[model samples]
Target: MTLLNVENLRVTFRTEAGPVEAVRGVSFNLGRERLGIVGESGSGKTITGRSVLRLIRPPGKILADRMEFDGIDLTRADEKTMRGLRGRRIAMIMQDPKYSLNPVMKVGAQLTEGLRQRDGMSAADARKKAIEALEAVQIRAPERVMEAYPHELSGGMGQRVMIAMMLIPGPDLLIADEPTSALDVTVQAEVLAILDGLVRDRGMGLIFISHDLRLVARFCDRVLVMYKGKIVEELAARDLMAAKHPYTQGLLNCLPRIGGSQGPLPSLDRDAAWAL
Candidate 1:
């Protein structure tokens, strides 16, 4: 199923210096599969994700030829319509749980808020589903963990909680922005496995945005490599090593190899023409 179709999507911000273009003519289609957008910090990766939900506020303008989700036009949807779609139909798992989670609220209370508001479930049912969500992410002692506040949990557990909260609403599409950036390898793998299982079993679409070339290539089905506000290369994730674009090659060369030459890794060579 084609869940999202975007064409010529552009994002610009009104900075004090002048108008700055963040995304330029970006276009792609997302189905019931994993799509990864890989880029450096200033490559407009986050802006692209925010633009999809019209999260870009005043002073930031979004213009698009077409942006549709499940055959509904997203670009023209009113605030009320977009609000209903944001958390219920399309969810976003942000990078850090420290900032995303409520520090004052209990884990269980925060997790069940969406269920109570959107699904209109009774308190007992919402709490039951909340525990199941925590277990789905393989959290041990979920009942104890639910009573603890967000500040008391470890980094890995906090991240898993964030994932559970996002998935509890049964969204059709999930946009995870650097969901595993701070975790150790073991925890990262565990989180990815949980996400993959849910996507496979429920047939949900995922848009994973990150800067790690190797991880994206291994974990995603297709990849869009962004540079200077444009997609420099698009290919199957398995073929990342064989990418032909010079920018893509430069990024691949920057990755360190084990037991290879001991010198520092190569630096990326930026070309002015590549942005065009």
Candidate 2:
């Protein structure tokens, strides 16, 4: 049932100062279930997810003792092989639609481009599929939306479009990095529900990377707490509030509660040894 198995994974960047290791020997396995990776900014959560798809370009290197997807060895996969897997078998939903979507391209074109180019789908078929995808994400009047450019869409609408585009390909494993971060509460909940339904119905595996502990706890089945490029804690999502690691506990303490306290939030105290 294991869909992804990453062990001793390391991502390093060749900086002028020295080689900066962003991901340090991180290891985890994923099944057809929601696995959330939570950490502060620059904690390597995004790096780990991107490494799986071999998305890291030069000046950066990904090394691992074992990085396998299903039965395929990911560490040794060439670009040609990776291209075959990228959107067809594995897909990623980036943090922001404004940055992720093509600014100049019409939404319809962007959505159907992959199908037309990669899958050899005809224009009519691809358009039909794209419209269906938009509908799946609960977008109203998908036809009009498709004709509009990315800039014409609102934040929530843009996000829904991104979700639809990513899901159109029917990937087996999805890496969503802060997918709902830019949306309002109502939109965020709807997006989460869409993701949840897809995972449940399609038996898809999900790697949800986010800084929102409360959201992850409610949405994901399991959680991986990262600190300074390493997984400091791994536990069931329901038990996240009761997490034993100082880092995880500190993060929970940082969450703002309504009517709980009138004082300013406490900052997370860092222990130098946690990085070692």
Measured by TM-score, the strongest candidate is 2
Residue 204, model 1: Cα distance from true site in angstroms:
0.6
Can you list the residue pairs that collide in candidate 2? none
The alpha-carbon root-mean-square deviation between model 1 and the true structure, to one decimal in Å, is 1.0
Candidate 1 off by > 4 Å: none
- The digit string of per-residue lDDT tens for model 1 on 1-276 reads 799999999999999899999999999999999999999999988899988889999889999999999988999999999999997889898889999999999999999898888789999999999999999999999999989999999989999999999898889999999999978998999999988997899999999999998899999999999998899899999999999999989988988888878898899889999999
The reply for model 2, stretches above 4 Å from the true place, is none
Q: How close is candidate 2 to the true structure, as a TM-score?
A: 0.98
lDDT of 2 at 18: 96
TM-score of 1: 0.98
Backbone Cα, N, C clashes tallied per candidate: 0, 0
Model 1: residue 225 alpha-carbon error in angstroms: 0.4
Name the best candidate (by lDDT).
Answer: 2
The Cα local distance difference test for each model comes to 0.93, 0.95
